[model samples]
Target: MSEKFEIRREVVVPGTPEQIWAAISAETAGWMFPSPLEIPADGSRPDSPIIADWEPPRELAIHMQGPDGWFNNLEYVVEARDESTAVVRYVHAGVFAEDWDNQYDGASKHTDFYLHSLGQYVQYFAGRPVTYVSAEGPEASSAPEAMGALRGALGIASGATAGDTVTVDVPGIGTVEAIIDYIDDWFVGLRTENALLRFYGRNAFGGNVDAAHHLFAADADGDAATAAWQAWLSGVFA
Candidate 1:
């Protein structure tokens, strides 16, 4: 027998519903940091997609029908929270044939950070170029020890909260000061002077832990940004 499943991720982002919608609608690419946001839209889905529904500033749902008639879906929705903020939601749900557990584990972790970057795009780097670099870890997508090492490197405590100031002496990037954007159960995001950085700790399908990093720089200096993150991760997982 086959099983149906659903996973939902939501976050309150620092923008009006209209502003957030613009960024979300801008593109449907990797949703990671190093991916550029200025690619021209061709009115074509990144991959072959069967459209389900589209409501501006509200919802975008697509059907991912496989050869065997199974369903895999991706959806995004936003609700206005107030004049200056809104709630953004992403859901990747449906049926799968094999390795559903491990695949969804990666999806769950990836989706969380993806939304974090989207919220960041709307908040700080709208209309700017971003250099995004992502790495799958020694467990690359979810490791508590890695997160701990990162929190230490950034001078943030385990109980850090939003609004806390953080300063990390990044090896290739020099000293960077940022404010804690938010802290969640397995995720943390930072608003640096010139970039948005996020980390994720998640479980794989088999229940083993893994981790990942996504660093987005709006400074257009992709080489420097990538080098800094690559060096940083090498140290963290060394």
Candidate 2:
């Protein structure tokens, strides 16, 4: 019989089903795995490198590049126990060389990370207290000041870059760095599936204001380099 592995985990996120669906469905190829192989987004290969069989809020099937030029398959089935809790089952199936027994452990570890990351993303987007910094003053001055403070306070640690992780301290939202997109003038754009939140300065002027504005759909949860600036401005100014 071919070797196989299965990993199961349940996560409770304080978001609507739509939000969870969007997060899970978003391209996670290079973001979710520790060393995810680069595959064409269109899955044009004769043997599709990455394929997703998606049924929103219910099931998702992923086929990724695997060892021996083979493909590893993962099926995620989501069952909503309530408005806030979701039971997720991940099943992995693939042919592996006998010497690669340890691959099972690696796969399991990757699954754990995936579930944890998804939970955090969902919770944060659901308006969980990820960070909250209070700025006392007029919106103009306080906003910019708060933005600068957040940027400085989140000092540059080693290896902090786009797609990496870092946290910012807000007065209400605790310190959390699911992923660092980039630091803008007023706010940083934190990558999310549904939107990119622009974290700006609290006291800054028209372009410099401390706030989180929703941008647009993100290609990956860890992609901080590209943002829908035009769409974001339209939404914000509108």
**Winning candidate number (lDDT):** 1
lDDT of 1 by residue, 33-133 (tens): 33232423653333423567667678767777766567888787889998889988888888756776766666677676677777766777665554555
Which tens-of-lDDT digit does each residue in 89-188 have in candidate 2?
A: 6677776655355555555554554455566556655433132211122333344345544454555354456676655543322353546665444335
Question: What is candidate 2's CA lDDT for residue 78?
Answer: 74
* Candidate 2 C-alpha error for residue 197, in Å: 16
Error of 1 at 167 (Å): 1.3
Q: Count the backbone clashes (under 3 Å) in each candidate.
A: 14, 28
Best by TM-score: 1
Distance (Å) between predicted and true CA of 190, model 1? 1.1
Model 1 alpha-carbon drift over 4 Å, by segment: 9-12, 27-48, 79-82, 87-89, 96-113, 139-144, 203-219
